[model samples]
Target: MKHFFKIVYCIAILCIADTSYAQRKTAVKAKTTTVNAGLKLPTGFHASIIARDLGVARHMAVNSKGDIYVKMDRVKNSGGIIELSNPADNGIARKKTVFGEYGGTGIAIKNGYLYASSNSNIYRYKLNADEQVEDTGKAELIVSGLLDRGQHNSKSIALDNDGNIYVNIGAYSNSCQEHDRENGSKGMDPCPILDSAGGIWQFKADKQNQTYGDGVRYATGTRNVVGLDWNNEINSLFVMQHGRDQIGTMFPQFYEAKYADEIPAEEMFLVKKGMNFGWPYCYYDPMQNKKLLAPEYGGDGKQVGRCAEMEKPVVAFPAHMAPDGLLFYTGNMFPEKYKNGAFIAFHGSWNRNVTGQEGYFVAFVPFKDGKPSGKWEVFANGFAGVSKIESTGDAKYRPCGLAQAPDGSLYVSDDNKGNIWRITYKGK
Candidate 1:
């Protein structure tokens, strides 16, 4: 923790002020400086950055008091969770403080305590009445030493209303076995990884030192679910999966080059306990519009036989868009049409050899009750810039994180250039 605060002290200096009034005013002043979003808004729709210049800010959660907590990568332990509090009415906020050097990828606020995860482990940080980081000595490991494959390593987390914390343990390999793409890369019989990796585990949110060795697998066979959210309306957990990569690169006969950009759909899964979405062995095909068997298990591009018993996605999207954040709208942030919709941050794609850029935008999937009711739409754009190519290569600002403010406003984080944007709507 000593090394953790050394970097934070410099960030805190920019936020601290001599007086309370000054702090609040600064927040509001920052709100008015936003770049215009055309003259179409009725009035009062404002957008601005909360905090900027941080590496690879991924998942984020806000507290009851409206403080923002972000799980950033590489700030010691790959990255510790940082808190931003006292957001101004004008939309300006400050990086208040940070703790928990264990640096896991998931962070959330549930039942008065702050929960954070590091690769290989999970921890619970106790907070005081003000909701500031209070030293409960060191954080208790809620779950530890999970499957820590360097690929797809950021473990996203979500908590059910019933007090169960769900953590993602992604599959280490691309497609399970080599028979996957090559002429003959055979899958491990029974794929033991399905038992541990490529799954979501449930643990007692208030318990102590509960490592992966003791936790129960809540769901299985997902590739890497980076965006996990609990919708109290449905009383279930929802996750957006970062789908598998390179169908043709690894296996040309099974899939063509065009299929790389147009094949699998990044899935929006409504995760229930004991659910399994097949990975390494199966993929959701946007072209054929069904779940297809992966090439690894002696299956071709269109076979669903290998995934007969697996679960399917609630909503389907284009391939390789890389959804990094998922949030359901419940606040008055936009029109009534958006009240129950889900906003997803597509971190963009690298698979398309066809043409130009995609996924450098935030998308919205409307939900009525618990099901998707309408086609998804682009909620925000301009991240790709006016004209550009070379996705995953020449991105100056890629949308990587999404968080809904307490006021129904949405915040998007850019990983390439470390900027946080608050997007709000005032028109009907």
Candidate 2:
């Protein structure tokens, strides 16, 4: 009887252990499924959170080996860049390593090098054959002394195939006003701010310590450009300009407060050398489909004036959406329609006080032969996790950066919560 009792007890213990293991496995699976269903994607597409709480996660880059390097908006723990490795092939970053002393917006992986930028400087690190940064402590400064006023100082960067790197030096003033953002203040003629800011500067990729004098002003009149990418298909640079704010408050006599919520379309420019997109002097109005003279420059919102000579945007988005990241899709994991298309991460709006906040999603622009072939559509949303955003603080997550993995999957980084979401498409 005692032996039989012992046998029953041992079996009971084994069953309990087995049940616990099964429960744990089920819980993990459920969590994964829940996260995958978090974002609202189109048919056959899914998303899963790979990394979380990464400290102001901004722009990101993926190497050939699928290693992800994400730049932080601010430095933390003596490092700014986070390197994630997924060895389990489960689409989650199981191992994370943080390196780099300084922090800023732009980060890209190029030919055997990882390039990153601070607000005032750009740096690069050598990569090994495994496509990992060879020395995290040893970084080579490529570009330095770029403009960094307290406002609009994100030095977003992109690299072209010809060994040239482009950096956006955003204009500090809202519209180059004599007293910035003040009502009734006239815009400065010729915009002295344009001399040192409000444009894209091109510098040599391999040249170290190159300053503004060593770089060329590739294009001008851009208010601020946080989102930019090198389009290999067109062999040119493309950028999304964050249009100036306070259209109504600054010029209430010309623009109604309601109009401020709609006019001054965020512009997508196919940038070329010496091309100007008319910043403080003019702003594009999508409803009118024309570049209208800015009220700060003495026009009542309908005059084209000197704006006729300024280059127009290839595509214009809604105002105050804050386009932060741009990635031209060249991967094959998605449908053929997505090939060579552009994905833009709108970081959401804050000052749209009249109409509540908008944006906080990734938008897709279909491209054919290097131009937008069709209308832009919402690619991924629900980052805000709410039906409407009353204020920027009400949002749960803000999509800030975008990157494509080697396997053709898309990764988006959230600045609010520091969550990195990996988006993949399954066949329909």
Candidate 3:
């Protein structure tokens, strides 16, 4: 009889423990969402608006002081780099200051200096301790007269540890050719267009008087690299390449509607000095795990070798994830496993007839000793409106920029809704 009573008590205790565990939300579930914005979150991560009611914020950078520098591509009259700061870690942004009336598409901070780039030019702003733009008032125009015909004109900036500034001068055309957007077209032989753009350029970051033409070509054949960062571990530059689009309409035989929607992988590549990833001529297919020849350059779905001249990607994701920002987590605020992982902001896909629009969230790519371990998982979601993956007609905001606070928390920006949300890990 006594033995039977002990068994009952043990069973009751076990059930109670299980119930308690199931009732709690993980640290990832603390994500806060914006009002009127089509968004949702998974079970663990939490999100909250860092700064509300802003312009079409594209790219952003945060310094050690936790001040945010945002670049908005809005009406020229009301555009430029702005500084945002809060009094405390969890405090709302209490200050906003705008400097340099000129507008740009990119912003970054390196070695105590703030750099902002226009679609066709680059500029720098002086900053003060409070993280304010020095009201020094005037921004020095570093480079001007770049090829900015609207398409792929934004120049995201990254600085290598060796005092070199790497600017992404995206190709104006989707696929480089003599005539623009023509079907059955082939890439330019010798690809002379690479000399001016469609690649990254290394410039003397300390040189105060350098111009556009003064920089050297760092890497080429990158169609459009809006997201770039220096992998301090690898001691090399890494960039996420935005693959070309309209594969089926441009070349029907190789690219079916199904293939077009999910074939060419948006690639993350380590840029070795002078290495070329054959853009306009080839694309890396994540499904097949191979570098396949592009439809425009002519080849079957499984074709290869024509793009052999190009470099390979370190990691290949779905066709249109549209990675716009890349950051390696160097802070210790998160779990130990995430120490060296990479976080990417996928802006979401717009062109695919894909009934279910994908992306519009932040993802973490786990790394082991500087190399991606396995599959990348969604770190923080809810930007897209649908609760279930199959549900459509809900997505409203598209994620665009990513910034890390001094505490290792992440800030995601969206141009679709013009709001920024700060994400922090509260997991045990």
Candidate 4:
């Protein structure tokens, strides 16, 4: 009888463990199933979850045949790029292929080649007549030895019609301080880091094995640009610059803690060759609508100083929004108002502790004659799934990449869960 009782006890223990394990598995599945649960769209727009659990989906490109190639923020299972083929009319991808061994933030399809970037290198693969990559193993190295200090290390890429490829080499330090990110640290004179980084570099799109010396520093003094697009409409390049951080924490004498979150504006620039945007030495103040000298350079938070000579942003957004992807919408599926406009993906903010967090949504900037025609508006929202985001980790989804389909559908990728949302226009 004692042996039988012990056997019954063990059976009960096994049953409890099994039930607990099943509950845990179901919880994880529930999280993924809520991919587009709280996504909000504008009138005449609807969204669907085309892919999920894709492993840090970053910038993506859709080919002529509607195949999507997405770059992963990090390599998973030896694959960094994911290909989705044969998407159904219901917005579901019928086939998913994961390839490439390297990973970074930039990917684009131009001409007959598919271009992608690692943190320190740029590579291209020839596409077949079907617009699919011909050989995944033979990625040609177009640019190499770019700076990657791993602090603002995402290398976003944009290509021009003139066979030139532009890459952003982000500044590693916050403000080029003599002692990085330290309180009371003075700015480094001339900022040697800008010699190789803190700007956009241009290289030959078709050339192989090109290094820093082989490329031209197209523009200078941009702190870190993650979102950039070549405006074929205007024959120019546009970029969104992430402003500096911790003005109050680093220099409280000059800026109050409450004002730090709103002082430096995330700037949108009409980039021109040899133009200086002024980073480390200056930051844009949206309140004043002017570029102001950075605190490290001895400004009292309101002085323009040398920043008066820097190029001003065409549009300025609230500070710390973390713009990650930019796409010029030239699609016919949407209303005429959306044509030639710009869509930006804000990966959301992390450092806006005092003001709570903002910006887990995509914004649209109307363009006329290649310049912003009107004020920017939030095109998509509810990505955070919560009314208030006290911290970035509390958000359910962070919009990181933007792509437009051949049929004029807009695709937004979430880096948090690797979910891709396909948004289409459905006329009323």
Question: Root-mean-square deviation of each candidate, in angstroms?
Answer: 11.6, 8.4, 10.5, 4.8
lDDT of 1 by residue, 335-366 (tens): 88788789898888887667555788888988
Candidates' C-alpha lDDT? 0.76, 0.91, 0.76, 0.90
TM-score against truth, every candidate: 0.85, 0.91, 0.85, 0.91
Over 11-61, each residue of candidate 3 has an lDDT whose tens digit, in order, gives 999999987776654422433323312344444445677676577788988
Per-residue C-alpha lDDT of model 2 across residues 129-218, encoded as one tens digit per residue? 999998899999999999888799999999999999999999999999999998788899989999999999999999898999999999
Reference-based lDDT, residue 267, model 2: 95
User: lDDT value for candidate 2?
Assistant: 0.91
Report, for all candidates in order, the number of backbone clashes: 12, 0, 10, 0
For residues 189-269, could you state the per-residue lDDT of candidate 4 as single tens digits? 799999999999999999999999999999999999999999999899999999988887777777777788786999999
Whichever of 2 and 3 has more TM-score, that candidate is 2
Q: How well does candidate 2 score on lDDT at residue 152?
A: 90
Tell me the TM-score of model 2: 0.91
- Candidate 4 has its poorest 10 consecutive residues by lDDT at 31-40
User: What residue runs in model 3 are displaced by over 4 Å at the alpha carbon?
Assistant: 1-44, 75-79, 87-90, 129-131, 387-394
Task: At residue 266, give the lDDT of candidate 3.
Answer: 90
Weakest 10 consecutive residues of candidate 1 by summed lDDT: 33-42
**Residue 322 displacement in candidate 3 (angstroms):** 1.0
Screening candidate 3 with a backbone cut-off below 3 angstroms (N, C-alpha, C), the clashing residue pairs are 28-44, 28-45, 29-44, 29-45, 30-46, 31-45, 31-46, 31-47, 32-47, 40-382
